[model samples]
Target: MPSATYASRRSELETYFDRTAVEAWARLTSDAPVSRIRATVRAGREAMRAELLSWLPQDLSGRRILDAGCGTGAFSLEAARRGAEVVAVDVSPTLIGLARARAADPGLPGRLDFRVGDMLDAALGRFDHVVAMDSLIHYRSGDIVRALAQLAARTDRSLLFTVAPRTPLLTLMHAVGRLFPRGDRAPAIEPVAEGSLRRRIAREAALAPLAVARSRRIARGFYLSQALELARR
Candidate 1:
């Protein structure tokens, strides 16, 4: 079960993505031109996604993958194209709708089963690999470890996720973001120290079967996030 804090944060995220910043998010994930700041974010996200994908096999023909917190479904689409059965899920109905709309092409290879719900839902079943992208960036370190533990329970091979890396620049930008009017502000990202996160993961009993495999930080202009991989031992 998710802790109360996790549930609350999930609600905040659903509202932010479904109602508050749906248009802005859609624009950011698309080819449509965006402001310079968003362009950097898009680029950074692309780089991170590519890095995560590179960790998986290029030919995923019998694999079952989970695209947890899948936003506009770019990563899910790619995984599906590589012949993985992908269950791309998100808490935002609007974002899921956009993903479904974008993936309407009948000729796309493999299958993309997009759902609107918590990515930690056990009903979603097991996966050979799970990619969380930037989904867990808003939660605290403990909550992140807990969430990963939950996902790790059903993940057979590996789990790929990203966190807002604690850094001078990111800390400054995060503080500045708080100054924005509450209504216009996105939910604050919770920057995490990589060392602390790794320690917590190590202490998590549910995560004991997984070992930290690979990690890389991607920082593009206003965007900064670290991708971490945990594979079954």
Candidate 2:
């Protein structure tokens, strides 16, 4: 059973993202609405996705990739375009529908598959690489660790995912932001003792960390986002 925190986070994500996938992707800065932002935010998000893809290599031809929690199919479709077979999974049927719409191209049909499944309950098949991108942001620590182990088991090469690091500065920012949050935008973060969590995940999942880099898009004082790459044992 999913914890209350995990279930609440899933509900919030499904409610917010399902209604505005495109708008969310075009985030100008922090949590500002799309109408109040510039085109650069969209480009920035694309760049971040590119960075996420960078963990692998220049060429992904003939590779099998799992884009777990893929939102609107951005990274998943990109992988397909680069000659990889991708399985794109997400929890929101609305978001999955949007992804399916994007995969309508004649050339993309054979390259990828899109499905709706929660991270905790999904039965993912084997793959050369697994990436969760920023989708695990609000997940509970225990669930995240469980997902990591399962991802590690199915992946032949490596697994990549993002986490919201807890720092003193970020802790302060979140506290203040909550008092005066913008409209219905999500909180900057909830505390994730990143160091201890990393250690715990490594111990429980039997995976070794390859790299942990701060994401340029969300590493400001508000959200100290880090992309973690774990290699299979």
Candidate 3:
């Protein structure tokens, strides 16, 4: 039950990813001696992994799980390793391909499924858990409610995600950075406030806020605020 605007936004995002995903992956995997790209990705994923593992229920053996916006398969792969039937979806073909290749590795083969699709349009079926880490920031302010509804519809148990804290200073920084000639590619540009975020989530889905962890600066320029919520449906 996504709105027309939501669908259109999803399409635009998919198109952007289709155009840039391969190049993004290439940069991530580049052989440049000065590059810390892969290490940064791994460290960020590890932090997210720890948070998710700590909040999730035990005895998830054989449960169905959906990883929405599953960039590079970090959370999705971990769920598969925990014996969940995992379907990982991302708008980027390159990211999905990388995830598939990672799944084909000896340890994770046949345990995960990766697909190039919008989280808003994918028929994800009923999942015991849904994860969207550091992904919702891409949504425009008005679209957050619809996006949360779409995500909640795909799951019956729990949903976990992270957002950049909505602070006046952070907002000002994003605005100023965007105006700078050389700050266009800066990492700390997107953030959402918790109050507005919670209101949107509540409007779109029957949900109970479980926990909100303090913002943790994970890498050179990225900061994350972890939230664990239960689907009340």
- The lDDT leader among the candidates is 1
Q: Write the per-residue lDDT of candidate 1 for residues 100-211, one digit (tens) a residue.
A: 9998867767799999999999999999999999999999999999999999999999999999999988888889999999788888899999999999999999999999
RMSD per prediction, one decimal? 1.0, 4.4, 4.1
CA lDDT of each candidate?
0.94, 0.69, 0.63
Off by over 4 Å in 3: 1-5, 26-42, 106-110, 180-190, 203-220, 231-233
lDDT of 1 at 104: 84
By lDDT rank, best first, the candidates go 1, 2, 3
TM-score of 1: 0.97
Evaluated at residue 17, the lDDT of candidate 1 is 95
Superior by TM-score: candidate 2 or candidate 3 = 2
1 or 2, which is superior by TM-score?
1
Write out the backbone clash pairs for model 1: none
Instruction: Measure candidate 3: CA RMSD.
Output: 4.1
Order the candidates by TM-score, highest first. Answer: 1, 2, 3
Question: What's the count of clashing pairs in each model shown?
Answer: 0, 0, 0
For each candidate, give its TM-score against the true structure: 0.97, 0.76, 0.76
**If both were scored by lDDT, which would come out higher, candidate 2 or candidate 3?**
2
Q: Where in model 1 is the C-alpha error above 4 Å?
A: none
Q: How far is candidate 1 from the true structure (C-alpha RMSD, Å)?
A: 1.0
Per-residue lDDT of model 2, residues 1-233, tens digit only: 55677777787777676665545543442244454234444544555677788877657887889888887788887788778888888877877887888677777533888888875453667888888877776766776776677677678887878776677876786688778745556634565677777767757733453333333334432224667777644
